[model samples]
Target chain A: MSDSPITSGMTGKTFRVGDFLLKEWEPGEEERIVAAFNRVFAKADPNFRPRSLDFWRWQYLDNPSGKLLIHAEAPDGSVAAHHGFINQRLLLEGRPSLCGQMVDSMVDPAYRRGLQRVSLSATLSNSFIGHTGGEGARLHAFYWGAPVPVAMRIGKALVQYEVVRTQLKLSCAPAEVRLQGASGISVEEPASFPEDTVEFFRKVAHCYKAIAVRDQPQLDWRFVRHPECRFSIATARLGGELRGYAVYSHGSFDGFEEGLVCDWLVHPDDGAAANALWAWLVEKARASSAERLTAVFPETVPDWIRFQEAGFRAAPTQYPFVARTCVRRFDPPWLRRNWYYTLGDTDLV
Target chain B: MHSRHPPPSRTLAIEIRPLQKGDEASLLEALNAHRGGCVQQGHALSSEELAWFLAHPSGTRTLLAWEEKEIVGHLSAARHTMWMKGRQVLFAELLGGFVAISHRARLGKRGLFARLCREFFSEQGIDGDFIYYGWPTREEWRLGRKLLAYETIRTQVALTLSVGNAAEGLPAEVELMERFDHQARWLWDRCAAKFGASAIRDEGFLNHRFVERPGYDYENFGVRDDDGVLRGYAVFRKGQWGEETKGLICDWLVPTDEPEVGRLLLRALEAHGRTQGVQQLFCLLPEWSPWFDSFQRAGFLATDAERMWIARTSARRFDVFWLRTQWFSTLADTLIV
Candidate 1:
């Protein structure tokens, strides 16, 4: 047995797991990559530590949307590690949230000689001929804990940290949604949101200093999926062309602090118009036996104020943060200027 | 990889027997019999905890040991089926995993495991593809290394938060109203216009949470401007309450710009008990929410927080679609940490 970490290489190269050629994994290697990763995991943790093989498969390789599985191989061409995303999805409300999940990512430690980087991008193309594919994927965040600290002199990372608590509080009132007032305002069933509303939102604030959401698909996908939400919509016609409208979504939280107004929005900052619309809807919720209103408000906006005035309180959720560095050498000079492609991205990615 | 092979020194026998209809009395007697007897140290589980463990779906596997005619040791485990990794997968956990001291040196663990694995565990598996991942977390790392045949995967934290009643569930100023077809519709619209059309409350989504609708207290409330303009509103639905009909704040909205307005609405909510005739408010706070601090400042005591992880059976990125259910969170309304 060799005492050194380096094993022998073949093909005029030093990296080898016996005799197969070593190469960066690509799309065609999905099955081999997934197999290798799972094999390595099976050889490591079998108590479902981070996830089970089934979990990694579904989340990465077997995803209904299809994915690319990256693999590192031995000189003999045996697969080593299965690393990378299963598929990409969107997170509405803000940011074009592209996501990449590491699945069955492992290495055959005995075969280690260098080269542990493995990746697999899904089917989406970044460019075909001369067109952009709007790729929404990233390989930055990882599931395991953070990197091994920068210095051994840092005293082995001694910090008396405490465990953060999480709770879900329910309102004591019956959540029966009822409206009690009779307003002269004509009510039309809320329609698929029009672009003007986003435009109106732009008028007040610049989309929270993130990527400008200047389209329809993103809006429809985000707010539409959570259907149980109740919405109050009022249309104000201006010269036969609808200029401004108010939209309120019925949202709730169970098991947090109390069910809250999860989301609400009124176009046209005119306090009177939005207020009138708010009054009508609040009366309805009051009549409907609602305990409280719920909304997802950003740090910016009158939402925090408006939500409170509407008889709702704020609640919070916390997620443990862990980070690691994969690149042996890192530099971001190229990404500095392309705000959209560089630093201007969402966490889901 | 080097494999460690130990010569077989002991034979293990495990017997799975159905619980007799009148096993309680016998079980109680057995427990009492062991009370004075020398059992393994640090191996005692409270009767209540044991009962709770046996009540869940996961606590199904129980193995009794017998040498000749005397019952010496036992092993207990659970079998559960749930939505994991985006699909349904069966999970087996070794809980209350114990063995008799006398049987320890004789390969008791290996025997019990081999027998159990023969009964409930399977080696062949596929998650769209063959995966052999492992980890080295302080808790589960040993098993993977012990198995020797497995590989290391990633490690993560499993988290949770509990839901319960506040010291006061409802506000004293709360009043319940009926859903006005047009007004509720208008509020829904305003919310949609302001938030987006996708936010309006609907039956399918609401009903998915619990069994019924219109069954909660503090059904709804409205805060209007002095001039009769709708300024704020909240809706409550019934849910798992530590006390009476819990107000699940389904929705809250106001047309102002101050965090205090949210506080005022919270104050109004705290006073709404008179209307609902109940004593609590409840809701779940996801880790991604921004108002966790606000709820704390407003006097809502937190119950617990736990890490969150998901099991996927397919190849798809996890965004918000994975709403995982977790248990045993230390969340309370008042705890600051």
Candidate 2:
């Protein structure tokens, strides 16, 4: 467990877990990792796709936030388990901080029994965040959405992980949507996130203890330039200054058409702007013949009140956002009150 | 307006019988007159709406007590089905049980309400194996417990959060759907096994309970992975629960196998709630619900008052602990809350 630099070409630190060896991913392990991922997940899901090296490279090597890839090697030199974290810049209490999102986690079925699964997971996580200096020292937290039950249990019991919030689904019938537009605001579906929109987000970022930096470039990369999924961006301006913006897409579910609001941001003080943006979206969805419109938000989010007034209902499905951090202290009530999240921040869509 | 026939005299003998097709007028009059009861306090239903209630999909049968042609007492038996263990069990919910204030004393000695309960239970038995349940007032609950061996399972409490100032949001990547899909059905299959007892949340049940519900409009939100596999789903509506203007989380399912899905979906709901301008977000979860931790983490505080989830099982045994943990009852499941 050395705090040594882990570069693509150089062999980094390694740990022994039972007879298996856990080490940082090297330069040429994409094929082995992909093969092991496909093999493990194919058993769980018959339709699981075999990811290509390009997709892997796009997600890992090309990510703006640096990637931390760890794999457990068996005696045969095949990958037994894989765990990775993609770096993200976050505003923690209005100050810039480094965080990571845990992703691409899997273990070979052969070595998943007893404590090996737990050991491999813990060893990899510890190696990434446990180092004392350099890049590891700069890491404040690692957050992820929707860990399977077993992972949640193990992380809570063994790793002191805490759940940040439970995601709740809410929906509204397009035919029943009613909203009073704000007189000062004008809304338009923009082709990209404008600079004013980014500035508006920055103005409101301090309202939450933690949030992703939603600048123009990040927004462009996330919603506009995403490889899969096409999102429609709507921006609301008051006197030509960006007050709020929303991202959504139209799709059908179970034979019923719907507009899914993927992401949204409104100034904490701009109730009128939020209303105008919502009214415009509902009207847009109705114009497109979507039977209903839906969005996902945390239950504690105050903005949900506006959606409810606009006729949205809470759905029964929910997801949990969990976090594990050594440097950040999340006071339960405060964390519950201030953390801002949206359907757009995760990889589920 | 011209006066109708005078009110029934005290000496008139009361006769109880199955409600006939022409009873809608009399039933509406009786319901409107009894404004003290919970059902009567809400907006009065029109004749068309009354007919819709009597013609509920699962089927509803009302038995009325008449005093020389004047309807004096009324009770309804609404049939339903619930998932117990892994099977659908026939169930019935009693609704609109009441007697005229002047006729109450005489009817008690004759056991009018008790007799109606007996007949309804017997009728359910003749139809199929059934569990008779209801949300009776405290007085009625006591009477039923003494007379029909009704058992109080667990009291369901309303959890509320003043979300007016909370600043949480939904994860942007998780997809929020407004309709049920194959992925939702898949998620239900993956998530349903953890519950000890619940309504069958399959596509048929969802379509009937939410999509096809009369009067109120409901929407379903489905969360899926990138591969289009369902992780969880929720049913919600915007309406008043008692006096509060609230967004109700009627029913939701995220697999205990994937608690993180529950977190993400719940957060998404909160964000939706903010945009809707509800005074509060309300959810009905049993104290022992596995999702209670998630709800609490999202800042939902439980109110001091609770509603009883009472039932009369065919086995004639009351296992309160099992009912507390196994029974997945929400406000949406009740005939009237």
Candidate 3:
């Protein structure tokens, strides 16, 4: 395995289990990886939307915070199993720590059963965790992800995945909504996030116990610079200072045309900014002709209650939020009570 | 994606059988000796409470694992009638399962505990409606899912509000009742009509759960309409859990369309709870319940309870997805409060 720490002179070792070769992903293999991902996921889920090569490169190869990709190769040199992690900056108690969000885990159907007793998926996951997870790993401090149901089961039994919370889908009818005007707040659809957005997030970061870094650079990479999908960025300002912002997009979720709140951040005490951004979102959804508007916010987020008050009905979804700590252990109760996340934190949007 | 393998063929010298007459005292002694002999590690049921725990209105059955003449493990399944999709169905609530600490280590996958669960579900399965449900602690939740084939429905949280100094005015139409009367049935009928699934909270269940419990005291409040008929009701218990002295809303029922009645009941409970030296009130109702929004409108916020609802079922209609989306439950439906 290459690109990982050497233990007992194992670096650059060509590890082989029977006919399958386990190794770290190399450059110039984006096309094969993307094709394998599309083929494997489509076989697993009929409704799975295939990813383009450009989308794959932007997501895993070109991420600003670096990438963690490991794969198992079949005898014929096709990618059999691949596990990728996207490095992220997480603010915990106002201290920035590097974290990884697991994404794009797939195994080729033909090689699902490996030569040895261990499965290809398990071999890839074990290698990924051994190299990237635990206390001494320099790659990231911890990892978290929203896994599908089958993966959730296997991860819990094998890789120490603890469920933080099940994601809730809050939906509201967009039509016939009356928008109230905020007295002094102004909302604008900016082409890109302003540089001051980083400072704005820093000013309000201490208000939350745990949150992803939602500064300008991260937001720009996640929403504005994505290869596919377009998001509307609405920034609310009071007297020309950034008070809050909301990013939303219209899409089909479960075959229903709905509006999605990908990311929302407002100062905890600034009700005016929140109200203004919410009004802007309602108008945006109405103009786009979306029948329903939806948002995914953990109960710990302050806006969860506000969304309910704004007539969004919360219901449990199949998606689950799971976390694994490498350097330190976080109590599930404490994490559930304080961790703030939105759909943008996930790869869903 | 491994295939399911059969349990180990090796067997210990343990016999699984149902509890016969005159076995209550021995079961109680064994459970009390180990402290929380039940699988959940809750308070051991007393002699009288044991009878009440096993005496469900629908029916009750207990299976015990025996090594020689000694009871090494036990599991109880109690039948409960609930309204599911507007029709009555009987489901089993698996409870009071505990294994002797000395025997647990030897039980393994083919041990006495696993054998007891297999027999319990086999005897009381989804055939006639034996859908099973239980509120399990973290340890039991893990083991139940692994061995007993339990699926999580949803993790429930508690809605809490601080009882402040400002006194709330109770509606004149509301009255605190000594016991639930026949009008309570009408109130439950109206409330049940609007729910996807709920326990049968008729007059008998109301009295059995709140008024007639042996060791606990609960205050029942009822609200009336202009016609002097009962329109809503709420059961509150001023209890201390750990260090917090709080008011617990054990059960509540009001028609979904009648928000005023719900608000009035909340005001009456808050005023009453404050007088009893409670600084906060806690209610455990599903977010899907219409009354949950009513509680939120009255200033209650959802907080973590560190508990989850899990069930083992052969019935397809009561799958995890449907339960998570449509089921409406309360603290009264569980043994938590």
Candidate 4:
């Protein structure tokens, strides 16, 4: 009944159960949370992939020490419910302030009746979900649903709110194409990428507010972090002015044709530039012997138009999923969806 | 309104207004007051996270409704850059929206949302090229797709894995780094060198961000060829947000592009979890990513994956031709097209 030292083998106790009492998630539980998260997302994701537990560790717990946590307990104190509140700051409508995100709420539904302790853990997570509701219980899992109504309400009230919108788009797949040699447009792959490509991207990123631009750090992290993408940069020039560019990458991934066009780019408006660049890309992609373009962002980028118009039809978009978080909200909003192609989870700038 | 389901006459007053830093305390307080009814969503506010939220740019400019200044309802519209058909477009997102318990049915929130939308579009020199939004429910998808000037709306799902299962016999060819020792650290640089410059390839980066970062274990494994040359590597770790430990196969690099190799990497993970005391594991892959095929083969039942939304921005409005043709050779020839 109290936050007292839980004794082992205790019965008739409503909530308390040994050291592993149900409590909201907090900063220190990052490891435990990551451990449980592996189980949580297995059923939800096909790849059940993780870029790095450290990335998540920093994102969910270490970074967002700002978030609150809660968990369920057992008689001898084993974590039955690793459930709780997650809070973080995010930009809203061009304004910066604390934006509550509802995330990481789970219950072993099969053991739903094991103990009211689970319910107690659900309430514990809500302790912070009511973040904006100051003096309220934490919200459980608002963006996503919760196991119980009580938990759901807690999660709901804490979130910034649900925006009823759909912005996800499907990318078209590549079609059979033949590249013809074009004149005047010197389209040659750079022998070596400009060292400043990352810097160039940093400056170029300010152009889109719809998506977050990749800072030098993020670029370095993704492209430098992994070697999955075979990235190369190309440019078109006239009158000594840079007219357009393409940063394409070819990579091999499982579950698809051997080689894939991981990335391709063409400006949204400049037809000639876009055309030249795309033709070059098609020719180049063909040269790579790529059966598919896996690294492509469907409609997320304006270049998608050139890709589709040239015959790339709908190939299922890669690694799709909903974004939910009340925990570990990143500062500065690095992972902007708008310019995802350039975002470069890999292949560098 | 078009599709009526249940709960005759929803009752909360849904107001939307610009949220300020000071609003965190009272907003959370009000939410706590309605703790029982508010259970369907969110974690309650805390002082520390509240301060952090206020400090982040995304948390700024959010609109909060006043139930007499009690912080009953809210709609946070976070703006960011995105790629739309290959050009930069400033996207105004409707994120983190919520209504107070008493403000439901009054259309307070919708009205406020509409007002924000109109004002945003109408602003003089608004400095944005496009707008888009992502939603959690069908009603949401329908609303944004129908009312807004967006071209496409896609499905989103989430996938989970339970580490409780025994995944034995995953080829143990890959070895997890014991610690970020000099040898291990040297491999990181060698692995990073393949990407070359323009990459944030640095020992400090890996050490700080992944290897030594708190809450993350550097269970980085690498497979060697006959010569013991590291040909493939996978950095798998447990990611935690709340309660469950999620076994995430975060990054994997292989010398072989074989399906068997991919399967083997997964097998290595399956084997890894068993020894690490992992009860279950799941990683959210990009929903449409074929990479998940391996996970499915490995028996991870995927579900609940959500859509990934993006907004892109560029200094100059994204001009597709400029973006594409600059790279596409025919684009130059097709100045005529």
Candidate 5:
């Protein structure tokens, strides 16, 4: 096999290796890609939960920042490998910017070793990175992913994926808790967020050096409209105004019923709202019969210490968060100290 | 060992040279002068200890940045053999990195510390022989990321537990050792596969780090089966931290999957710590290690005092992400002991 001509595709760079066409994903190809994704992942793991077209469209096309996808088409017209990203709007150092959240990287077992002995997934990544971010290209400043173990190795060796943090889960046994005296704070699970959520998030945005812009649209798209799991949200109101909110989901992992704190957003000074939301989550966890309640937040986040004080002990989890910086301004150390993230920022929730 | 005098025109006539036989006093003076500036405040090493620090049985080197006659900065690299990816790889630990207080004001963007690092890193890159790592304070870590291209492998977290009653219901026999014997080596060889990456904890490294090191004492305990085959080993030091007496587990090595062996070793340490009147016990571990979960299951809790673990590697195979997931280290791999 020999390298062939390079042509422009959707992201503006394409490759032809022997008979295989390394090209950009285009319209009307959703079913083909989703089938390939399910096939590849199922071959890799016996218990991989197959992804659906609804999930693919909701994650990639329906996102506010739009979709970016690449694939390698074998001679038989099957997708031998695929790489994709869903762009996210980020508040970087108080400036709005775009970043890509990589997802659904897959390679068929037969085409695992791609062109020139590099993995196909790596080839797709290289092509994707070449066309995005930096200078006058796409506006993405960086790309991040929570990849599986094998993909992580290939990415580290071939694609320069620097580890941002090994995500540590804070977990404790769920216990009953009673709300304290009249703090004028109320907690409830609302069917939908009010129109003022965007304003509230904007007011709280200054507290973070880097974070995802979690407005009403993003929340609705991520939770209420998600194709699979049902996520419950609890909002804390003071004087009948939204002060904070927390999102949670329940599942049984390894035979232990667990309640996951997917997102927690409250002003560092708003202890009352924070406590009310915490009590609500605890009661919810207990009512749902969850043995353990788990939450993940960077140690640099302001609420990390609060959760620790609230009896959440740092425990080990298998997820490793990694990022590739396409822009020079954001390096690992700076990101380590400044980036605020939660489980909601990832697709795992 | 190599000596380099930077281009006199570019740098301010600074000379970066190797440490010679009679340089201990000058180095100690410079280190102690800026004791609390950026470096850690351990008791200043005596001449003998300094000599030992510079002397690795395999290889060691120290580079000093000099402005005419005064040493302005110092850096040292000592060779370590690590078990990584099912094989032994040569690595170096960078230590005693400091810049003199007087020189800080004059160091522009291209300063003496940067000069020393350039000379050292260029030499290492050209040789491409070993990967180097260091434990930097948060401040130093920020500087290192910019100047030295250091990437973090993991943050060091100390797992602490109130010294309680000895562990019970262990199936393995525990034996206390004055020093690591051949069985320790045998055990390490058998169990090295369990870790994706770790400092080689064979008998020689164990003796050098725990038994024969100066100015500190550590108790070595081994776990054995009914046939007396050593399955694991742990090193403990009774020390003072804050206002309490603590038993610090400096080094631990056991197959992470073998809970019985780990429990037996921990029980021995707890019993020994209890006899020594230790109020609490502490062990520094990377969360990536399954043994970290084991310690947590044994009732250890994570504390807030996390230190940065950074590394610079020229090896193509050992990338930052791979090392972050695979590397297993303890306090013994650091200078804290």
Candidate 6:
């Protein structure tokens, strides 16, 4: 169980932390890593089920964009801490860039007991942050969704993580939402988006300084091939031209039936299309006997006002989106307001 | 105490009294009329639906401002047992407060809201450590603050994130279920200490608040270990938010020490959302929630707007900061949401 050479398909660079060995994850270390995860989290969470090797493989090896996993091992060969990131492709003003999503951060409870000369949490985080843009790693920025206060404190102290914007949860009863007329626009629930709709999203995406690339393949994987949920897509057209599209589903909240509007994209200048698409969803939800409907959008996003116009009331909770960039420095105030984000951009749903 | 104001031109003597049993029909009519004028979409609730509030186990009492036989203004106070500072205390929540459009001008001038506030507060004497509270609209909040001396508690912010392109995959070992089992009873006891002040989430409360709710289908996801022990759980629903389908996680229970349980449940929820084609996921957590890091790591961000949790204590004067820090409130805690 002592620190020994382990076989791995992907060669990873190693670093030293006191008596612990910190390095990128090797292929043969999945079981050991999973064991560490279970040991640290199982008693804390009674419902914690041990992750399967296949799930771990799919997350790290079979992901379309690949991932970066780093683990810290004690002198006796037990995992002390683990930090990893999955690669993501983000379009910044129509230009593609590599982004890293931080995930699966864990620290062994024993090592986390007290502050010492070598802080395991700080060391593990610093190793990943420092190595993000070095050698084989090409992450332009690191982004995280609703990070806990502890992570935010650590991230702010270590890597200058900044809060970008908060996601607002706006809700309303489906029976209470009145649809306003949008002249020359019609809504249709399509099984799959047409080619024109994809092109329309591309055109709309270019209007934002930052947005997820929603081309055909990305859209198909996001809305269609999602592993757990099914979505209904509605497209708005004017004179047979794609103007906007909305994705929604029906479910229950707090024992009450509800309709959720997950993602909505429309031409930047086409207010009518946005209105038409929203109204159509309301009618659809009402017909399905949904008691209420809810949506989450960034406050800075223009869609917030549109949603308010459509009778969505604000819920009392919000999440702050944080990010760390290695390549560029931009005005924080401007980026905070101009960035386009929707519920689709986050993994919470 | 009925305050007889100087009659402004009309001879209509307004009588304010506790709502009686037969007042249900008139109250319903008044509520529907008020809703019809204000609400653009939702229809009036049926008498049966309205009866639930009147017959609530918490004991609902409405103070109706009547002009002769017709109801002019309505305000209801429902009793709720709240866990505060490691103790259970009775509190009253003011809900569905409205003044008829025809009587708005007169009521505003006569200080009808102030009168209602005084009466409601007086009704709960110093004998019980009762707290009067309400989730009023902006205008109503302002009015209540000015007239009732209601202090602002913590403003709850709705955190949201796009589930699109956010990893929807969950670990295979975690089982996501739709209903709660016997193990859930101990969940509140295990986590209650962390929440200094919150609703008593016992088995009965869980069943009453979520399972037995009328006209709603709530899905509960219980996170279990390999041995089928409940570690954490989350209650959520799929609903429409504007034009997109959204998954709303209403109530979440994970031990404070195990923040990862929240993370695991959230990831599993995202996987569930993917199956439903939910474009986004949202949950309402306090600004100072212990699990904020889990939510942040899960990709939820704070929104610019916030909703307030305002209150006024009838027993004594309380510090706003103490109330804010100790109060564990959520959308599910209130009947309005």
Superposition error at A29 for model 1 (Å): 22
- Worst lDDT run of 10 residues, candidate 3 chain B, spans B34-43
In model 5, pairs of residues that clash are none
| True contacts reproduced, candidate 4 | 0.10
Please give, as one word, the docking class of candidate 4.
incorrect
Q: Per-residue lDDT tens digits of candidate 3, residues B240-286?
A: 54357689988888888888888888888898888887988988787
Clashes of each: 211, 75, 1, 259, 0, 78
TM, chain A, every candidate: 0.39, 0.83, 0.88, 0.48, 0.90, 0.78
lDDT of 4 at B249: 57
Candidate 4 lDDT for residue A230: 49
Interface RMSD, in order shown: 13.1, 11.8, 3.6, 13.3, 3.4, 10.3
Candidate 3, position A343, lDDT: 84
**What DockQ number belongs to candidate 1?**
0.06
User: What does chain B score (TM) in every candidate?
Assistant: 0.36, 0.80, 0.89, 0.48, 0.85, 0.83
On TM-score, the candidate that comes out on top is 3
- What pairs collide in candidate 3? B107-B111
The local distance difference test score of each candidate is 0.34, 0.65, 0.74, 0.41, 0.74, 0.65
Q: DockQ of each model against the real complex? A: 0.06, 0.02, 0.21, 0.05, 0.22, 0.05
lDDT tens digits by residue: candidate 2, B1-337: 8679755556767788888888778878887787422233366756665765666556666778788767777777666666667676666676647777776654452556666656656765524636767766544654555556655454344667665657766677566555565555566566567677666556655665676555766656667778777778766677776666787888877776677778777777777788777767788876556676457546566442224467667653324345555676676566563
Error of 6 at A298 (Å): 1.6
| Candidate 2 accuracy as TM-score | 0.51
Which wins on DockQ, candidate 5 or candidate 6? 5
Residue B184 displacement in candidate 5 (angstroms): 13
Poorly placed runs, candidate 2 (over 4 Å): A1-12, A16-19, A113-118, A132-137, A148-161, A251-257, A287-289, A331-333, B1-337
